[model samples]
Target: MFQELKPIQVETLLETNKNETPINYYQCDSYVLRRDTTNSCYAIYVVKALIEILYQLRNVLFHGELVPNKGAQNVYKEAYLILKMILDKIR
Candidate 1:
C-alpha cells in the first residue's frame, strides 16, 4: 500500500511547488511537509509526503470538496492504506 501511494504522494508533492500556495495553506500556514532538497533521505521524504497528503485529504473531505467519484475513491483509499500502515508501524 505504501509503495502504491508513494508515487501519488510524490507527484502531489511535485505539483505543489513550495514557492506557490499549498493546499489548505490558510489553515496549515505552511507546506504540508517541508522537503529538504539537499537531504539524502529520499525515502524519509516520501513517507513524510504521504502523511502530508493524507492530511490534505482530510481537509478536502471536511470542507466538502471531495466529489463522490472514482478518482476520489482512489485517493481516499490510498490515504486510508497509508494511515493503516503508519498505525501498524507505531504499534
Candidate 2:
C-alpha cells in the first residue's frame, strides 16, 4: 500500500527539551515518534499518525485486521483523504 499512500509532504517538527533540543522516542520497531517543536505543535502528531497508518496496513495485510484482499487497499486510500483534509484546513 505504500505505493498508493501519495504520502502527505509534511515537514515533521520535533519537540524541544529544557535545553531546546529535539525529543525522540522509538515506539517499537514499527513506529517511532520524534518531537522538536514547542507546545501546541501539530507537525509531529500528523507525521506520527501517517506512520501509524502505514504500519497498521503493512502488518494487517497478513491475517489480522485486514485480509490480503481489497479491504487492505481501502485503508491505504484513506490516508490520502486525510492528507487532503489536513491541507485544506491549513490553507
Candidate 3:
C-alpha cells in the first residue's frame, strides 16, 4: 500500500524522514534517493527504500536481534503519521 503513494507524497515522506531524523540514520541525500535531473523516479526509489528498511526492522524484531527501547519513540510516531497520510490519500 505504501508503495502506491503519489510521487509528491512519497517525496514528502522522504523529505520528512531525512530532515526530521526519524530513522536515526544519516540523512539520505536527495540524489541518492533519485536522479538529480528528474523527479520521475524518486518516488519509486523512496518507496522501495522505505519498504526495505521496514522489512529489515521486521526481521530484526522477528529474530530478536534488537530489543525495543524508548529511543524508538519517534520511529513509532512517524510511522503512524506516514501510514495515516497514505490512508487519507487513498480514501
Candidate 4:
C-alpha cells in the first residue's frame, strides 16, 4: 500500500505585493511535511492528510456544500480503498 501511494503536492502562492519568494525545502523524516524535489512541491503523510481530508469532506457533506462531481467521486473512491486496506490488515 505504501509502495503504491503517491505523495501529495502542495504549492505556495507567490506574494506579488511583498516580492517574496517561497523557499524550497529538502526531504526530512519528520513524517509531517517533506519536500518532493522531483515534483517541486511539499508532500504530507498520507494517513494524516487523508483523515483530515475525510473530516472536511464529512463537514461539507453534512452542510450540503459538497458537489457530487467526478473529482469528488474519485476522492471518495480513493479514501474508501485506503480505509478498507487498513481495516483488512487489522482484522
Taking all chains together, each candidate's TM-score versus the true structure is 0.51, 0.33, 0.44, 0.42
Predicted candidate 4: what Cα RMSD to the true structure?
14.0
Q: TM-score order of candidates, best first?
A: 1, 3, 4, 2
After superposition, candidate 3 runs with Cα above 4 Å error: 1-40, 87-91
Native-to-model Cα distance after best TM-score fit, residue 66 in candidate 1, in Å: 1.8
Pairs in steric clash, model 4:
none
Off by over 4 Å in 4: 1-46
Which residue pairs come into collision in candidate 2? 14-35, 14-36, 14-37, 15-35, 15-36, 15-37
Taking the tens digit of each residue's C-alpha lDDT, what string does model 2 give over 13-71? 33232332344433435555454344665555766877687666666664476555576
TM-score, candidate 4, is 0.42
Worst 10 residues of 3 by lDDT: 16-25
**What's the distance in Å from true for residue 48, model 3?**
0.7
Q: Regarding lDDT, does 1 or 4 come out ahead?
A: 1
Q: In candidate 2, which residue ranges exceed 4 Å CA deviation? A: 1-40, 63-65, 68-71, 77-91
> What clash pairs does model 1 have?
none
Model 4, range 7-91, lDDT digits (tens) per residue? Answer: 7655442222331134334323542243343554434454566678777877887799987889988987887787788789999
Q: What C-alpha lDDT values do all the predictions have?
A: 0.65, 0.59, 0.56, 0.60
Give, for candidate 2, the lowest lDDT window spanning 10 residues.
12-21
Q: Which residue window of length 10 is worst by lDDT in model 1?
A: 19-28
| lDDT value, candidate 4, whole model | 0.60
- Residues 1-91, model 3: lDDT tens digits: 6667655542333333333323322345543232323335455666677667766766776788877787666675676577678679989
